[model samples]
Target: MDHIKKVGVIGSGTMGAGITQLMVQNGCATVLFDIDKETVDKAKESIGSRLERLVEKKKISTEEMILAKELLQTTTDMNMFKDCQLVIEAAPEKIEIKRSIFQQLEKICAKDTVLTTNTSSLSITEISGQIENPRRVAGYHFFNPAPIMPLVEVVQGLQTAPETIEVLVQFAEGLNKKPVVCKDTPGFIVNRVARPFYNEALRIMNDQVASVEQVDRIMKSAGNFKMGPFELQDLIGIDVNFATTQSVHASFYGESRFRPHYYQERMVQSGSLGRKTKGGFYNYD
Candidate 1:
């Protein structure tokens, strides 16, 4: 944990920005970077507004809010990450983009510095293979709204050293997060075990066992899930959810249980991409 005083977050969209916010909230100095300057600025503004909400809700004192804002350094320059001890990449879900970033980070950061990715579906080994120090690179995946989410998946690649995992678990705990160490298997733990919930729910809907609304209601009441598959899909973005399912399915080599639902693909194609698009299985407006 002491090795993580300075953190660097690449990408400024939802996940990257959220990770940066969490690091700052944990009293770590964070440098946020994106290819686009405006995006980085937007990420900063979004975090600022979230901190203000915490202030209004009395979750954090005004002084803490000020300090939170001060801990983050949002920028478009990649070189600023040179001094960071740990850098977490949250770029698009493309292997090439990740490889490029890791190669560049290897050049910029110290040889002993730690590097991790927030990739949900990609194989950690495949990503780390792009860099020189695969031993120092591992997967540090976080659920959305990172600061609020307690669970973090610490992925051990095929070549990941045990000491690295120990340090990562300690690092996550330092930020007051629960860390679950798992093999670099597809979907790690939660996404792999939870696939049946979504796949079966989608099958029920497609089979006309019930409508999306009714299924969601039943799941919430009977299954005790805070949100049902369709509803959660909508909130997570139909495309994003579908893509994750597909990736896991492919990673499993077309396993029957992990099959990607046809309805989900159709929804994504129809642009019913959840709350961000204002429409999905349910309507936003």
Candidate 2:
């Protein structure tokens, strides 16, 4: 497996910043890109702060943190990704946005540069459908808190080459993430298996069977899970979680099981999007 030395992450949002931090910390020269200069600059600051925290905690030395920071580069220009051996599209989960990014990347990067999407539920095949090299396009879904999350779903689109899957699996492992290969499917694996977890919790609350806090408590204690569905939703962003449910539901052709609850939609509409917004199922403020 070829080792990916230089990586590019498109979008400087939460996932994008986390991925950039992870790459640089793992010794890869990383380029973080966003259309907005301010957003990208803030992301770099956030990444730096996180590394400082790790240094304070003794997880990494001062030298290591300095080296990681040195390896990171932030840019508002998409053309800066030309030299990246692997470019992960951590842009918004919208299919059109992802398609446009991959299309643009195809023109900017080398033919063999692996173009991967961090979309949790969007169809990888559809996103890369119009790209010149569909085989190089695959889904590289990472959980929230990319540096800490161990599981990475390596999704193979219908046209994704076997070599592409192999490269991604190796790259993911190189980053110390556990990679699971799966065919293109709605919600892939974790999100699909976990959809009912959130939906049912919302249903129970909506039906007055339990309060939000009560539901989370029960799941953590009874289910032996680290976090309850509602609490997890708050961390993952209500809008993002809701969008995944909607995507899976549509992919399954309105399957009742994957249906998104209106309460979640209402939270999104209300702009109570979770930790970032300081409010969601539970208030951070």
Candidate 3:
């Protein structure tokens, strides 16, 4: 862990920004990369504003915020990752895009530099299959709002080296997150085990068995869940949740247990993609 000082984060979007913030806050020099300068700049601004709010609440000192901002850098070049000891790719959930990033990273990164993905649905083994050193590729799945989410699934691909997993587990711990090791399986742990929550709720709603609010209330009251399925889907982005369900269902060869509901797809198509879009199951507006 001592040797893993400089880190690189690809994709300066929501998850990328959060992960970069986590790395910098924990005293690691982090480089945030994106396709263009504009997106990177916006992400930096958003992260800076968030850190300023933390300073206002005394969650972090002004000096600490300043240092974190300084420790974080934004880049439009993949070559900037040349010096990174660890690089986490948090790009969009597209396999081809991830494959291209890994291919480029292989050309720029050191042989021993650890590479991981923040993919919640994609297969880690498949993502690393074409890479020069598949041994270093693993999954470092973080939930939405990465800094606040405590659980990080450290998925070990079929070809991933044990030492790579050890370093990532330690790295996640360094970020003050709980790490769980799992094999490279579809949807990994949380997403795979949690399929029923959203899928069943959608089924119930579609079958006219219960309203979204009613189901949410029952789950919170009876199931003791902090938030109901619809609520969680909204928070996680309905589109993102839909993609996961679709991926898992396809991975299982159309297993009925993991089949996605049409209602969820309708929400995604309607652009009611949860809290991010101000609407999903329950309207945020």
Candidate 4:
């Protein structure tokens, strides 16, 4: 963790920005990158606002917030990541896009710099296969709302080195996150175990066995889960959740247990992508 004084995060979306905030809060000099200057700037502003809210809530001192803001740097250039000891690619869940970003990072970063992906379901080995040093490529899958999520899946690809995994585990702990090591399996651990939670809820709603609200209510009251499947999907983005289910299902060669519900596809196609779009199983509008 001491060796990882600087970090870089790509994509500048919700997950990327969250990871950047976590890094800076933990005293790492962080560079948040995106292709669009406007997008990166927006992410920077959003992170700053979140830090301010934490200070207002007394979760963080004003001085801590100031230091965190100072530690953060936003950029539209990929070359700015050249000196980062660790780079976490929070790009979209596309194999080609992730691979391309890693390939570009391979050229820009130092040979020993650890490269990780925040992919929920993509194969880490495939993402790093084309790069020169696959041993340095691993998965650092943080849950949504990274600053609040305690568990981080430190995934080891077939080619990933033991040293790389150790470094990631220590780094995650340094960020005050609980790190669990897992192999480079599709959906790794949490997402794999959680598929049934979302899939069966969708199935129940699709079969008219229960309404979305009913299912969520039961899960919260009887199942004792913090958030019901439908509610969680809305928070996670219906499209993102559906895509993860599809990826896991396909990865298992169309296993029935991991099958996605048609209603999820319909929601995604309709562009009611959970809270972000103001609608999904429930409407925010």
Candidate 5:
């Protein structure tokens, strides 16, 4: 909203980096913040390489790539966000961490600055509950590999101003994303509806109805899914997917259908957290 030319992204992980890339590519000046300089430096290198790859693929011109890189900046200071028209928090999915960030953001950001969380499972209303001005806080959920994903969920908390939602929708579109406005329900839309795809697959495997390989093959071949549930889980990180399921289950008050299978929990406990850990439902080694 307000022709957001300067934006702040409060993380430097995969999602944050991708969001920053999207902002700069769209000609918005972006500041990426992290707790430490090492992380900020690494994200800068990763973003540079990604933009260069886009240029090599002819997806972007050399000049455009340079312009994007120039628009991007990094810092460890939260006070630097004073001028940001919008700040999207892509930090980890911890409530304390998020609440703390918002508390600080309330002091640093302008009153009109649209503060939003990219949390996939956390309740937007609850996340904004502690903010001084909850009206400006909302959810701006982006999927993994944000640069390639076109869909964005503009979630509205109970206290979120209607104009905030309107602003987020237009802001999403400015980055060439398809924005869908949704109530601040747990898991929102995709994560809630798509849970069965992963859970039932786990159930089937645990029940011996089929092996992991068989279930994956069937889902890909017969179901015509781009990636099998297991394959997708591996790519998404087993721990991450399991945490989302756990969060949904808790939000629903232990609904039977949303119950997490023991096998899934065991995978996280074993530290086989998918490709990031080099092992999960399948071994990458």
Candidate 6:
């Protein structure tokens, strides 16, 4: 893939801010965008604090951290992204919201510029189709804490060009991330493969096979996972997790195996999303 010197990241949430920090740390000028000025300012502050912590831990030199912060620009204008080589949208998961951002990005960005979405659940095929040049649009889903996560899912939609995927594979690798190319299906790879983990765990709990704590312990010891399903769910946000499950389940047209459990729905419905709220399936409070 050709060199990507400038990156535009839409949204200021944990995922988006982390992406900006990582891109800048890798020597790319990153422009971060959000709808509101306050959100952008908060994101900037969050990134600064994170970098400061890294410096304190001796993970990065203080000078390097300052340079990384200098490389990051925060903005609310989509027009600012016109010069970006690759623009990654990390906006909310709503399809309409993403489509709107794509429409705006297509208008502001050049024809050769690649438009990528960091959408974990939605279909890249559908998201790309909403834009003018679907061939140039693709999924570039990153795991939570993008700066630290090793894996990146480089998904190609039905109409995505091979060169686009190739570009991203190199791009992700340059960021010190392992990129895995996959066809843009419902949940793609990791999400699909990992679905049964959460679903079956819920099923087992409901069936009295084990309690949530026992299931987590067993999975961690025997399954060799850093975190069990319930623990991971709490960390990822129950609402966000449930939404992804629902999206995948819906994308599969209500396949029984992909069905989301009501217990998760209850967690979301009750507004007990997760760690952000200081509680979830396993209470943090």
The candidate that wins on lDDT is 4
Instruction: List, residue by residue over 160-235, the lDDT tens digit for candidate 1.
Output: 8888888889999999999999889998998888788888998998899999999999989998998998888877
Q: State each model's CA lDDT, in order.
A: 0.89, 0.93, 0.93, 0.94, 0.92, 0.90
Counting only residues 3 or more apart in sequence or on different chains, how many pairs clash (N, Cα, C under 3 Å) in candidate 6? Answer: 0
Q: Write the per-residue lDDT of candidate 4 for residues 226-257, one digit (tens) a residue.
A: 99999999999998999999999999999899
Candidate 3: worst-modelled 10 consecutive residues by lDDT = 276-285
Model 4, runs deviating above 4 Å: none
Q: What TM value does model 3 have?
A: 0.97
Q: Write the per-residue lDDT of candidate 5 for residues 1-285, one digit (tens) a residue.
A: 447989999999878998999889889999999999999999999999999999999999999999999999999999989999999999988889999999999999888899999999999999989877999999999987898899999999999999999999998987889999999998999999988999999999988999999999998899998889998899878888998999999999999888887898999999988887888888898
Candidate 6 per-residue lDDT, tens place, 35-75, comes to 99999999999999999999999999989998999999999
Model 2 scores what on Cα lDDT?
Answer: 0.93
lDDT of 2 by residue, 1-285 (tens): 356788999999989999999999999999999999999999999999999999999999999999999999999999999988999999988888888888899999988899999999999999999987899999999888999999999999999999999999988888889999999999999999999999999999999999999999999999999999988998988998999999999999999999999999999999999899998988898
TM-score winner, 2 or 3:
2
**Candidate 3: deviation at residue 141, Å?**
0.6
Query: Which residue pairs come into collision in candidate 2?
Result: none
- TM-score list, all predictions: 0.96, 0.98, 0.97, 0.98, 0.96, 0.96
Clashing pairs in 6: none
Instruction: Evaluate model 3: give its lDDT.
Output: 0.93
Could you tell me which 10 consecutive residues in candidate 1 have the lowest summed lDDT?
234-243
Candidates 4 and 5 compared: the better one by lDDT is: 4
